[model samples]
Target: MLLAAAVCPHPPLLVPALTGAQDGPPTGPAAEAATAAADLRATCLAAVRDLLATAGPDADVVVVGTGPTPGSAAPDAVGSLSGYGADVTLGLARVTDVPPTGLPSLPLSITIGLWLLREAGYDGPARARVVTQHATPAECADLGARLAAFPALTVLLVMGDGSARRDEKAPGALDERALPFDTAAAEALADADTAALAALDPDLAHDLLATGRAPWQILAGAVEADGRPWKSELRSSDAPYGVGYLVAVWTPA
Candidate 1:
């Protein structure tokens, strides 16, 4: 069976209560919005998962959904990503939207959140189906709870900058709210060489602590910026293993 978790920004996806008479379609706005949304989802998901693989190796990799509507299974869709030993789904709902007097409604931020998940090699399928159905907080929470209870569930990786408290203990869960990306680790990678990072990739090492919940390996590769190699040696301050960061280097044999 597949274990899943739910993570969303507080509040929730806000659809304008009042459908006002609007001007003509904002083509430029729509196009720009779509592009920006895609980029953000990709980047944020990557950063988050990258940090996780480096820091939280025991976590079961997952897919971060995008858009207001949760994802549903498709007949043509390939089953699960058995390679990583985990499954994931994502929704583009703005669960973190604050009201008029609350925090700014940044629906686009979901893009970043989803992106971070992808960057870390967490290419899982989407099981969420609320993005199109307009899910309520209770409904979303209920689904999340079920996922957390899943036997294979190990962690509920939430994005945004907030917190979540899952009551059940069967599948120990974790909620990593809006934490800053580990820029120091990236910088360290920039300064380190591949020789020192071989073990950083899970495939190269077998001693990573395992809780038997979501056990997987991280494959390390050399750093590259703009198609060029970004080389450096990762040090203690830069790469804190078993914390919330992992830094590894890889080279062609």
Candidate 2:
């Protein structure tokens, strides 16, 4: 099951290249990208591993997601973390086709969600997942119900552009919200393109997921980095571009 969603393009692109169609060993840009993702993955893994290392071994940390340089998908295990073993499952796969920058993209931010899930010991795989650039209110509601199934302590981590929006609408369900945003300069670079994604603002990003009134409502409101009033709340061809957003965690009170 997907515990968190990430918006970064680096991981999705790099993972496939590192574990390419006949991989002996990952090398070149793909290898570099894989290493970078692994490093981040390790950071997230250690957060849980530290809690489990002394806590005990039933320490089930499942990082479920498509392929890349880990689990059964990779030619060989990339490298082991100090405290955890990752389980790469098939359901975590990304929609095939549309290579980003010549590299296959996997929802790499899923790793963070997996780490949080492992820390809480809610290890069941998801029956179905909604993977997209953004999810609608209906989608968030459906996901919330699916996540509520695990009676055990569970941490719902959301990664990506619309995380904050989703959680604000339903804070009682999600546990955490995270996004790996580009720094100020990086955001500035996006502005130059006039691209939808390029408008994101680094500073406006929320450090943690904000609570949502209704898990799905979070996906409804629109925002702009400049604090400019929304030109139109109603869906239209000309809404002001949104740059930067709030990611959040929702849990039952």
Candidate 3:
């Protein structure tokens, strides 16, 4: 059963290296965004560390993220940010003698998970799984149930962004509906409301461009399958750079 879970956003900029040169201190809007990103990154790392602790030493971890298709990687799987113009490379495990299997590169969400594990110096066994953004709610729930059935103590690290159209300058442009959707999502996560998360409409989520919809629904499934009391704490919630980024931690009550 899942002992702990953490949710984080997967913006490439979360990595300092991807934030461009630090030749000089940023000013104006850039400075504000940089500060916000830095804080979010720190919070995300802390939440992951807390998750690891909740799972206990050497616990097995399952990292979930959204992608174009469903795929999985072993603990030693390596991912690179070169596509994002950074040469930084990260792996799911702290040390791996295993070489690449010539599989396709990890999607953005899993890559971010890899970075988080490395940053937290997590030395436990962990693997990454990506669910397609278009996956149906039922499919997500099924996957979550399977994950919850892992024999050993398992912790889930879910990575995805809420919405990209929270403001006029947002990536998807400002949408009046975006805020309400994100607000509901944040509330559900904070309350550990599995029903609310499970009931999230795929159509509405797609319309709002909420990348976290499928993954969050998967989490709801896992919680339900585990059939244990849990509580959630909202660590951070904000629309930085017009994208809704929320961080939350859930542990058994």
Candidate 4:
């Protein structure tokens, strides 16, 4: 059964190393944005830590995120942020010296998930499952139901971002409808409203460039299958850099 869960955005800038900071101080808008990103990163780290703490030391963890395809990887799988111009590499294991096993490097979402686990000093067994953006709501629900069957205490770290078209400066540029969509999503997450989350419109989400729809729907399915009363806390919700990033934690009631 699901013990706890954390939802976080997977922006590459969450990593300090990818913020493009120089040896000295930063200036102008870059400084302001950097500070905001730092704050968001800290909140995300805290949420992840709290989520993992809800489970036993030996409990299993499942990291769910959006990717180009659906796949799973072992907890010890390796991932790198070099593609984002950062040299940081992370894995689910504590020891960084584990030799590579010729497996494909994890996608950006799982990479961020692994980074969060390591940052939070989580030593428990954990694996990553990536669901494609194109996955239907039913498909995501099916995946979540299966995850709910894990015998041991299980926690989930879900990584994905809300609308990227919140403003003119957003990655996808201004979209008048983006704010309402993201606002509703934030409310659903904050209230732990499984039904509302499960009812999210995939077509509208795709149009708004919200990548968190599928993953959030999967989480809703997991919650439904677990059949437990749950409570939630919304840690942060903002459009930093014009992308709607939200952080929240869900635990049994």
Candidate 5:
């Protein structure tokens, strides 16, 4: 059964420790972005707490995000940002201390999601699903439905970001369609609009380099699967670094 959910962005910088608070004070090239990210991080953390609160205690947690591979990670799967210049490593749950068996490590998106989970003081065991960026809308929807079918009460911590090409500084560079696309996404997330999410154009998303497409669709599918009335608050919506980072908390109405 599905309980509630929190949606967030998966940028490595969300972990302040990564960039020494990600650009330090508001007086450098990334000044404005730094300030925005700090605010957004606060909102995201709060939203995460709200999700946990809505689910109550002893609820099953499922962490969902976009990644290069599409499937469940080993419960003991490891994640690291050492390659990203942060000398830290994290696990899906507790550190197994053993070598990885199949998957090398949890994908970057899932790894970051786990970091947010830890920051929110959620130290429970969690299942993770990494949807491929190229997955079709129907595929993500199927996965979402399956995720909500777990016997125990379940909560979702969905990780993703909207268009990354909002401006010239964006990774995908400027795209006229980025703003409207992200605006629509932000509105949908704020209102828990599943139909709008399911209708997101993958081709346009791919062109704008929006990695959140699959993960957001999964969220919509999960809500649809639950078929329960839910209300939501869009905690934050901003493209601090030309990447749309949204934070929202959804509770059963």
Candidate 6:
């Protein structure tokens, strides 16, 4: 059965070290970026904590995120943030002494999820699953149902970002549909509306560069499979650096 779930963005800047947010307070033009990064990071951490708290002690923690290919990883797998230009080791495996390159690379999305779990001090059994962005809504939902069948109760930390084209400066540049697309996604997640999620248009999402579509659909599938009325909160909904990033939580009501 599914317990609680959290949704967070997978931007590398969430690592404070990357943004120099750990150095000290920022001034001038950098302040806005720093502050938004801080807020997103804090909310992501809290959402992780919230889901963990609601999920019983023995519940299995699984991080589901989008990637170029579909796959899964065990906690023993090692991960590194060197690709993000950060020296930090994402020790989800809890093996600090192992050189990062000693193990095959964990997917970038999963690495971000592990970083959040590690920061929240989640020293328990954890797993990672990756769903390719091109997956159809039906495919994502089917995978979600399977994810919920863990022998023990389960909690999912879903990591993926919304549209990347919200403004003139966006990676995909401003698209008229970006805002509406992200807005609908935010509302569906905030409301735990499985039907709405299941109805998301994959082709449209692809156009706007919304990576969260597959992961979010998976989340909805998990809850629907559990057959429970769920409650949700939209913690953060905004586009910083022109990319849509939404933070949210879902729990069996």
lDDT, candidates in the order shown: 0.29, 0.29, 0.85, 0.86, 0.84, 0.86
Worst 10 residues of 6 by lDDT: 91-100
State residue 94's C-alpha deviation in candidate 5, in Å.
Answer: 3.4
3 or 5, which is superior by TM-score? Answer: 3
Where model 4 places Cα greater than 4 Å from the true spot, the runs are 21-24, 74-76, 93-96, 99-104
TM-score on alpha carbons, each prediction: 0.28, 0.29, 0.93, 0.94, 0.92, 0.94
Better lDDT candidate (5, 6): 6
> Stretches of candidate 6 above 4 Å error?
91-101
- When superposed on Cα atoms, how far off is each prediction in RMSD? 17.7, 16.2, 2.0, 1.7, 2.4, 1.7
In TM-score terms, candidate 4 sits at 0.94
Mark the 10 consecutive residues where model 5 has the least summed lDDT.
95-104
**Which has the higher lDDT value, candidate number 1 or candidate number 2?**
2
* Each candidate structure's count of clashing pairs: 51, 28, 1, 0, 0, 0
lDDT of candidate 3 over 3-32, digit per residue (tens): 899999899988988775345667876888
Which lDDT tens digits does candidate 6 get at residues 1-253? 8888999999999999899888899899999999999888999999998888988678888888887668777557766788778986664454455544456457777889888987887766578888888999999999999987777888999998889999999999999999999999999998999999888899999999999999999998888888879999999998988999999999878
lDDT by residue (132-238, candidate 2, tens digit) is: 33333344334445443444433323333232322333332332332333232123222321123333332233332221112222111111111222221111111
Please write out the lDDT profile of model 4 over residues 6-28, one tens digit for every residue.
99999998888888654456788
Model 5 CA RMSD to the hidden true structure, in angstroms: 2.4
Model 4, residue 116: displacement in angstroms? 1.1
